[model samples]
Target: MEFNTKPDVVVIGELNVDIILNQIDAFPEIGKEILAQGMNITLGSSSAIFASNLCTLGSGVAFIGKIGKDSFASVVLESLNSKSVDTSHVIQSETVNTGATIVLNYDQDRAMVTYPGAMEDLRIEDIDFGFLSTARHLHFSSIFLQPGICEHLPELFSKAKSLGLTTSLDPQWDPAEKWEVDLSNLLPALDIFLPNKAEFLLLTGTSSMEEGIAMIKEIAPNLTLVIKDGSNGAYGWNYGKLVHQPAFLNTDVIDCIGAGDSFNAGFIHEFLKGSLLKKCLKTGALTGAVSTTRPGGTGAFDSVEGVSKIAAENFKMTL
Candidate 1:
């Protein structure tokens, strides 16, 4: 698929090597250990999969992120290149090792332990404003995990907005058992804010989704907020109307690792095609559901034709 000469979206975040161990009955105890049934290594990370899916769906994508000069980074770059995501803006660092995650799958649930490594070293100074100015949209992820990016988000989004580029952000779960941030200040800079129900609640300090949405609206009056509810589906508010889209049911569950990233890709894909907000939410849910049936986040799909088929069969929407 030939994309437009100018890039449609640029994804800025972290890339990591994911080492997945399959079929474990339970997480290892402090002093006890258990062996996994199978293991696999793959290129993983929110930005990586987001870019991959966008490229697969025939979007012009450029990824700006940090990785170490190790073989892990090599594998990630190779994978991205194979998927046609432009990697010219990916910076190579020597101080930190490329990030990696150890995933243990038990039953249908999984546990992950991640070392930020080079991901933490991604600084705003490494960004090239000129490259970002060329994109129609900017998708940012894992901000809270990368302190540097989180601190400099205002400047980054300000530059993008100044250039008339719409900005979207996905804040990953911060496992620190506490949520800290001034959403009131951050949300105004973002055109789209995508967060899972749990993250939304944590960020807003609200007990109900309704309250969370209200709080977000208060902060970012002009922004669109998307709240992803795992199996139940997704909810979005645009033009003061609430839209709910159910998740596409999948028969088999593989790994839920990159589901949200895939959802982001799907949402952006349909939104770019001028789909309605509700339809875009459904597309995101559909892609996320389909992603759970696959083992890896950046796994192959039918791209436009395949997603269209899924939409017709599962989502009951015409592409």
Candidate 2:
């Protein structure tokens, strides 16, 4: 189906079923069992959350990803549909299993173990560029984990750029040290690179954020680099200007499973609206802060006005 107008954002990456186990005291020892106070199932994934958050912020969003023809995949599809995100580009695989993650949350901290499953099958052939061509911005997340997608990064980014689409990437760490592609070649193709503190350190092999920023600049001088430091807030280096925004002060932390994704949505929303970089960072911090107060990612705010209220009353971000 064709949209009357192009969507503001198209997210391409992994989609998964997230099983959250809450109120756990600590990690269980091997072969040992523990009980959790609560358990919940949610539709989640880097790209999925980002797309849903963008839609929640009132941007038209389309998601392109792969999911298996399983019950979990059905749940994910239903969740995305309920959120009003377009899922026309999603491919259903008959043989593979839907990717799944088990999230253990204790206090504000969390640990996740993921099984890529069908997410690893997402390839260039699976992508329907027709959907991508109709987007103003493209967000590619969890690239490192999806080996097939990584191989076609240059071509995909190049095509998107030719079509005048802004491209962003949220780099996930390669657990197996299998990052063979030279990021220098890919960095220039991306307009924005959002990496958390640990991922930035691994990507650039830098001891500090300053060094990472400096190193990234040498390769892609014009690219905007945003590094998220949990609790410490976020820092950005754009066009030689440095911007640091503190996290919204939250006394009670519920779950942080999707804080980073919420931040990305907030930043992209403000950026697309032509807001200043500082303002975008503030919005992102507020998005993340409010997300942490909720149980899940997409339920953090019901509307843009909700986010605005959180920004004003909870975050109190200053320009």
Best by lDDT: 2
- The TM-score that candidate 1 achieves is 0.90
TM-score, candidate number 2:
0.89
Q: All models: lDDT?
A: 0.83, 0.84
Q: What is the lDDT of residue 206 in candidate 1?
A: 89
TM-score of each: 0.90, 0.89
Query: What lDDT tens digits, residue by residue, belong to model 2 across residues 1-319?
Result: 3456678988998999989899886678899888899988889787888888888889999888899998998889988887788887788998899999998988867888999899898899887787688788988999766887887897898889888899899987677865555778898888988989898888887798888888888999989888999899999899898889998878888868689999999999988998888888888888888888777787776677776676667667431
List residue ranges in candidate 1 displaced over 4 A.
1-4, 23-37, 106-111, 300-302, 309-319
Write out the backbone clash pairs for model 1.
none
Candidate 2 whole-model C-alpha lDDT, 0 to 1 = 0.84
Q: Which portions of model 2 miss their true places by more than 4 Å?
A: 1-4, 21-38, 104-113, 177-181, 317-319
